[model samples]
Target: MKYLYYSLALFILSSFITPNDDADYEKEIKEWHKNRIESLKKENGWLNLAGLFWLEEGRNSFGADIENKIIFPTGKSGNFLGEFILSNGEVFIEAKKGAEIYHENEKVEKLKIFPSEKPILLKHHTLRWFVIKRGNKYAIRLRDLDSPFLKEFHGIETFQIDKKWKLKAKFEPTVGKKIAILDVTGQTSQQDSPGKLIFTVAGKEYALDALAEGDELFIIFGDITNKKETYGAGRFVYAAKPDADGFTSLDFNKAYNPPCAFTPYATCPLPPKQNLLPIAISAGEKNYGNH
Candidate 1:
């Protein structure tokens, strides 16, 4: 993994210093894009997301039938698979007599789905449903591995991968700072922000707040190309945590679309107001289709 990161770093550095052979540079980028597509096609990928049903404060009937409070994709599950009971912020699943649902790889007739340590994934055939908490609302995220979108997917269109867009940045720590993150659902939440990243492009300096995502720094940034060449909501980029010298890498060439770009079911975070840049970033993935 470190080798791959450094390889791309070298490829990106080539634009500034000595350039590598054209074939080797393109090979790394081609492999990177190939892995991106493979990830989107995986069982847990965004393409298989079929439904995202918000669980109300009551028994929410869910099945393949249209009348259920939560409906699975037509052929993914049985007509009357089960019902999710959400009471006082807790979620429990009660499957029908012969309906199949498994938690922790064991068949379950009735099981507590939420308020646990790890995420409990309930699987039935090629369908999988998991409980997720977003603010005060609880939702069941349903995925079908055999989704048509996964089968019909070709590849996302991208701009010519250029090395110049990969930039080295300086992380400036912010004391007692939090950022307001607004999701596509119009719900705003506050998250801890380490600081802003400052980088220079074409002798112009720009700063953007960096939100810690586990060990990575997640960035939701919008540029002038939005609504014309990229997803209207914006694109997402990630970087490794800062080193001892407060230095991190930002590769705009890897900035890609959010989950909402591919599916309406995703509650993706929109770029913050301050993160919108006036400049046009012509690297990375382009708008695929009107979503």
Candidate 2:
């Protein structure tokens, strides 16, 4: 009688347990998209990218003048704004007097740009620039806080969220494998691939090369939806690390556009040949305006 009474009490409590799964899932995705927009609007976001000027081995003069080795946009800076001296893989800057260039808020006349150390950020009016090293090459990456792209950005378009797009996946480990990633700048780099994530969609099996990124797996992928609905170069997504049994999920709803979609200055890597899916993936973000 005591066991019967306890069983009756447990069954009565279980009857009250209800979950609004669809509403909860939709709200979760809505919140995720909102955070994505906020990130792109931040000060360090891609929307502010204004220019990418490669530095030569010798003195690279920069200004608004057409003759400059690195030209700033017209009316943005002085005709003889500054000179970046690249010698033996180290970069230094000589700011022209009265050009009003400031480094870390202090007016700079001459300073080692510190490419080996943390890059020294310099400012001219609304423009902020710093040195960046890519393999054996170095360049000045400029950003404008008042960029027109940032001002005009409302938000990105995305397909409606659906639970069916969240797919169960199996991770296949590939020891000592490297994937060649080509960038928009025509540079090809070999990135380390820890493994591949195999999943099924619409009763068809597919696989994507997974690169290690912190605690997540970064994936650059392409599909039939490209050129028509997505960025022509490709898209990027992240999946959590597989559990002990090598199981995870690929949430297509979280797939997003690469930095190149927002600015031409970004050197985003193209999706590898193997990652190009043969079917249309009608989820995640769409192409940005006239990208």
lDDT of 2 by residue, 166-225 (tens): 889999999899999988888888899999999998788999999999999999999999
Per-prediction TM-score to the true structure, in the order listed: 0.90, 0.91
TM-score of 1: 0.90
- How far is 98's C-alpha from truth in model 2 (Å)? 2.1
Best by lDDT: 2
Q: Judged by lDDT against the true structure, how good is candidate 2?
A: 0.89
Q: What tens digits encode model 1's per-residue C-alpha lDDT throughout 31-143?
A: 88889989998888999888889998989998889888888877778899878999998999999988888876889899888989888899999988899888999999988
User: What C-alpha lDDT, on a 0 to 100 scale, does residue 106 get in candidate 1?
Assistant: 89
Give candidates' CA RMSD values in order.
Answer: 6.8, 4.1
**Segments of candidate 2 deviating more than 4 angstroms:** 1-19
lDDT of each: 0.88, 0.89
